[model samples]
Target chain A: MRAVAALCLVIGLAVPALGWAQEDKPAEFPEKLEIGISTDEIAISSDFRGADLTIFGAIEGYDPSLLAQSKYDIVVALEGPKDNNTVRVKERIFGIWVNRRSMTFELVPESYSLSSTRDVETIAAPPVLNGVGVGIQHIRLSPVGYLGDGSNLTEFRDAFRRLKESGGFYQRDPGGVQFISASLFKATVKLPANVPNGTHVVRAHLFRDGVFIAEKALPLRVMKTGIEQMISNAAYNQSFAYGAFSVMLAVLTGWLASVVFRKD
Target chain B: MNIFIILGMGAAVGFLSGMFGVGGGFLITPLLIFYNIPPVVAVATGANQVVASSISGALSHFRRGTLDVKLGTVLLVGGLAGATVGIWIFSLLRSLGQLDLVISLLYVVLLGTVGTLMLLESIRALRRAAANQPVSLRRPGQHNWVHRLPLKMRFKKSKIYLSVIPVVGLGFGIGILTSIMGVGGGFIMVPAMIYLLRIPTNVVVGTSLFQIIFVTAYTTVVQATTNYSVDIVLAFILMVAGVIGAQYGVRVGQKLRGEQLRALLALLVLAVGARLAVDLVVTPEDIYSIVSEGVYR
Candidate 1:
């Protein structure tokens, strides 16, 4: 009877300890995404061509099993300044192509550069990506005005994406994101030659087994440097003065040329 | 935006303008459009370019004692008012997303009509020269409906009592063209002054140049203020190349016959207009285009 009691106690203690060890609770903090860029602002010179930007990041509290199985996916996007964009479609009218219909999408990014661990679509379902607005094809483009039947919505949206992609404004790199370590990641995005000068947002998203788990965003400013930027700034900020100066400069140039090339 | 290409375009247009004695604004705007510059930028910068190109000609006219200040002032009154109205129209069309279409259409029509008329006139002159026929000269003091108009004013330089109604009306028309088409309007203004208004031959070119300088300068300032499309770097490169080319053009022009120069210019204008028209009719590779509003300040 004493041996049986001892066996029961041992089994009870051992079972609970085994259960506790097996059912390991997730870290106190959920998986979090942290991203860092070397510089907060990029100064574009007058002769600036396209540039590649590298972002380093880390996934905190990530499960080792998921990381080893490559079940984790990372997507990093650099979104340019947002503004209302209008897409116009030209149709044949009287044997001439003319812009007959237009749709304005409210607060759309001027440029977008996306990098992902794998194809964003293969990583997650379309609905999920659309909900997160993570992929170029999934970005939300809500029309500002009234719609009659919403039939043309898809057509216009597709056109907007197609044009943006062709113009090199919207870009995607399926294999641009790679894991440097167990939880550390590196993502590279492109800055187009004609990148708009404004505050941009670098968004990092982490997915575990096709499910979004974490997101982090950092702000970056793109500034133009040199004479071109100064002129552009003057044109926008002090418009009237700039206008007057343009006229004065033209006058001076004209006067100087006339004096230099005087026939008399 | 290849600087060398832009310089070449400017120099080419400048040479032609010097040879033909006209502002290169009309040619420059179309060429910029062909080079893929936005129509808005091309138009505004073209106006700025005109301000420079017209200055030298106007200065030379002023020095030659040919400019009639009082007559030009009367014209200026109408030009300034016309430019204001034209700007309003320009902005309205821009908002409607029809500015490029309208500009292209206007260029086609204007270039077509002007080219046809100049070609025919030059051909006739050439034929007359071949037949050894004396050129028929219109009497300067001939009376017409323009002369009969009210508000006749006397100008000592032109030595004619011209009606202010026709003078101001002509300036008003040219002013609108200057703002919208980015032309100095000298090609149209010169013929109108001599044939329509019966201004003295000596004073006609000078008077038109005087009006052009002010109107184009005003257009430049207004376009810069409103559109913010005037590219100073682009304008500077064009102006420098243009002025230098004009000097050489003037020398070559002295050796060319007026009839041949006019005919050549007319052909060039017609060809450009035809190219623009073809672009309008041709099916674009992509039927869709996007314009980002208020994205760039």
Candidate 2:
């Protein structure tokens, strides 16, 4: 009797899966979403080192019956301010290194932190990710003014990505996003100490069967505050005054040291 | 970089600065390069730190009334002009992606030449001492090509009468080196003053420190404003530790005689130069590298 009941359960599970497979119909996306950052504004002080950015959110409107069926995979990416960048490749030319080729990429973010529940390749097809611009590799690279073959240009683009990735600007963690419950997910992104101060965009994407069904985005501000803020502002905005101040401070320090450590 | 690393490097460099009377940029720059700080940032920040130490040393001399203010002023003028031009060239090299190569080559040449000369001179002095031969500290000033220039001036403090053109030219040359190499130019400045200008040893130290003050300050300001590469926090950390390290280094310097000290400093200088030279001759692990224009944002 137990065996018969087990068979019935198996058939019951397979039938619905088969029916859904045969349906060949598109699935509904998330009905609603809610998201937030650990802090709306990040204030970097003089002693600022680095911080972890916790991005958490909850999804809604998924079938209640399939709650335990691994319903969705989430990807959260924090894209810092975007700007144009030039990537140069150096070649060893007769005992010296020189830049031989160069390419410019528009729409490159100053910093990018990406997190996903699974490896991005497993999350979706390359075409799908490329179309949606899901990963660092998927970042749009439209060379503005360059004279190079398409294949060679791609190498330069790859080199840019590689270099940035090593520099802590471009980051990704496959298992960074954790599913807390049936509908809630969270991710932790590392904010580097040298993170550029600006308005950053945080995006949370939900995927099912390698298809992007829904996503949400929020703005987070990384800024300098307190005396550090004033100094940083002066350094860039009122650069001359800042430079003069730095020089003066050095001189004063030197003067003080001389007085303190004078040989009697 | 880790705080510990910065602190450690600062301390090590400071000790050297105090002992050898070098600006420590010679030591600091190569170490920073090893730690992977961008060469541009290293050079700019190195100048920023050097300004502080030079000021401290210069002030002590000023108090002793050993510093030649008149001579310092003249050098300062030439330094200012040279610093501006050097900064212009630095920017040009940065754009061409040749800044690192140029700076490294400069280090190799400067360190190699200076270290070898110091080593030979110190060894000769050591032999004279061991052979029980009387060692004359200073040779009488002799007429040289430098004396033929125009604008003659008498520096009572240094007790020398020389052409202002050569003084200005020397200062200008050192200033150009300061901006590019991020040093106070003390290592070269002292030697130039003693050997070329034939300045008295007592006046040379104070005067070199005096001139270093203005040149490095100008370099720091220009680098901060034009390049925006000066990391004030990094500079402060280096300065504080450097100042302290210099104190300890002073104590160590007192124990070593002049010949031994110069010989050791020369060996250290040559070692660093050799390491840099090897990097050029040997194939790099990765020939391809990337650099972003402007502050990396």
Candidate 3:
């Protein structure tokens, strides 16, 4: 009788499991994150000043109890294209300040702007943030060569972060992310006036109860337009032609000036 | 960054260059550095500006039958070779993070020496004028150690048979300066041609200008291709303003006594050198800095 009862219970559970599998529905705890940008491309002109970029996102399959308790947190970051960055520290040598030591960080973002619901440190543990590499302070900055004794690693990293922050290439807005509704959020990140042109990425991370749950990323292209950009492009892409043209222009200008100002 | 400021700066430097018979590249590069433009950009763009400034002077000399084409061509050959070597050194220093320091140090030495010499010469000239003494000219026929060198070349335009070795050497040295310091090197080249090589004073300015146009033009092209530091817009604005200002400056210069103009120019050069020296000795605002590797794109 006990075996029959056990068999009946197993079949009952199997039927619901089969039904759930057929419906292709995930468990309630598996919340999903989705983000959208109004435009995937940003056009920068000669007169471009720093401006704000807004990103909209929604959380799917969120728990009602967790939402009521304000357990959900969102952090969105817009990271510029990555390149090798070198940081140098100057020391006094022979009454002159000179660059004495330099460390190059491999594959780091040229520019980074972060927006979060609250202070990133308060929202999650330091280890969690570091693991996710979400915050500017938490981003990975691995040095490009051998580091002896691992000493001065922190010093160089701190200096690099400080310089980038001071130069306005790296920025953060702790309160820039806000929840318009229970499941939707809006985040605003800054685009510096000197923002690099390349394929940037807009990354959105959702954390629940101090635990990271869902993350989404979308590519954003930053393009420079107008004559300035055209000139820059020519300089890099068709450098030889551009160089010849510059020489020609200078020659013409000089010849014209002499002709016009001839006293003979 | 400000167009008006740049235009004004260009005009002021142009006025001084016109008055002193200079290319103005030295003044432009340092002034740009002070205005917060990167030293690399300033150096490259200054070379471009020199090309424009020199072309007109060279052209005028050509029409006046003062320029020595054969000598200028020989100098150009050496200048091109030297520029290639200079660009290599520029890239090396840049990668080592010492390019700015080296540039500043070189300017300090060049400007300091040139300024002091000019001041001393001008003071002597003023004293002589005050005493109603006759102006003494150096004998052109006097032989120097430079004449002993082999591979002599006849430059009929200057009416002198000179060693190609010294001419090419001088051109090479000036070429290096043109690439690294962003100066047409006329200030040094003119004096060297007059005193060292004993070239005829009548043709020295024209020949130097001819060589300067080609050397600076070559430097501009190479800098654009290798460093991508030549700013065309900045160069154009500076050229336009500079040419306009040079016209007025020539008229004003004609009204001034030679010694007085030299004294004023000496003071200006000394002031710029002193400023650079102070920046080097004094404590900087920040010691830590960062450079992003790769192109902006």
**Deviation (Å) of B80 in candidate 1:** 1.5
Give stretches of model 2 more than 4 Å off. Answer: A1-76, A94-100, A114-131, A166-168, A171-196, A203-217, A224-234, B2-8, B136-140, B153-161, B281-290, B293-297
Number of the top-ranking candidate, with DockQ as the measure: 3
lDDT by residue (B1-297, candidate 3, tens digit) is: 799999999999888888888889999999999998889989999999888888889998999999999999988888888888898999899999999999999999999999999999999999999999999987977999999999998999999998999899999999999999999999999989899999989889999999998998899989989999888889999988888788778889999899999999999999999999998889888888888887444
What lDDT is reached at residue B276 by model 3? 91
lDDT of 1 by residue, B1-297 (tens): 799999999899888888778888889999999999888888888888888888898888888899999999998888888887887788888877888898899999989999999999999999999999999987878788887788888999888887898888888888888888788888888888888888888988888888888898888788878878777788888888888888889999999899998998999999999999999999999989888887346
The alpha-carbon lDDT assigned to residue B47 of candidate 1 equals: 85
What would the per-residue lDDT of candidate 2 be over residues B196-249, giving only the tens digit for each residue? 877777877788877877788788888878888777877888888888898899
Local error of candidate 2 at B176, Å? 1.1
Considering TM-score, where higher is better, how would the candidates rank from best to worst? 3, 1, 2
Best by lDDT: 3
Off by over 4 Å in 3: A1-29, B295-297
Tens-place lDDT per residue, model 3, A1-264, is 010000001111222222322233234557777677766777787777888888887777679899989899999999999999898889999899899998999999999999999999889999989988889889999999955787998999999899889999999999999988777788888988888999999988888989877677878898888888999999888878877788888898889989999999
| Residue B93 lDDT in candidate 3 | 95
- Greater lDDT among 1 and 2 belongs to 1
lDDT score, residue B221, model 2?
83
Query: Which run of 10 residues does model 3 chain B get worst, by summed lDDT?
Result: B288-297
The number of residue pairs in model 2 that clash at the backbone is 0
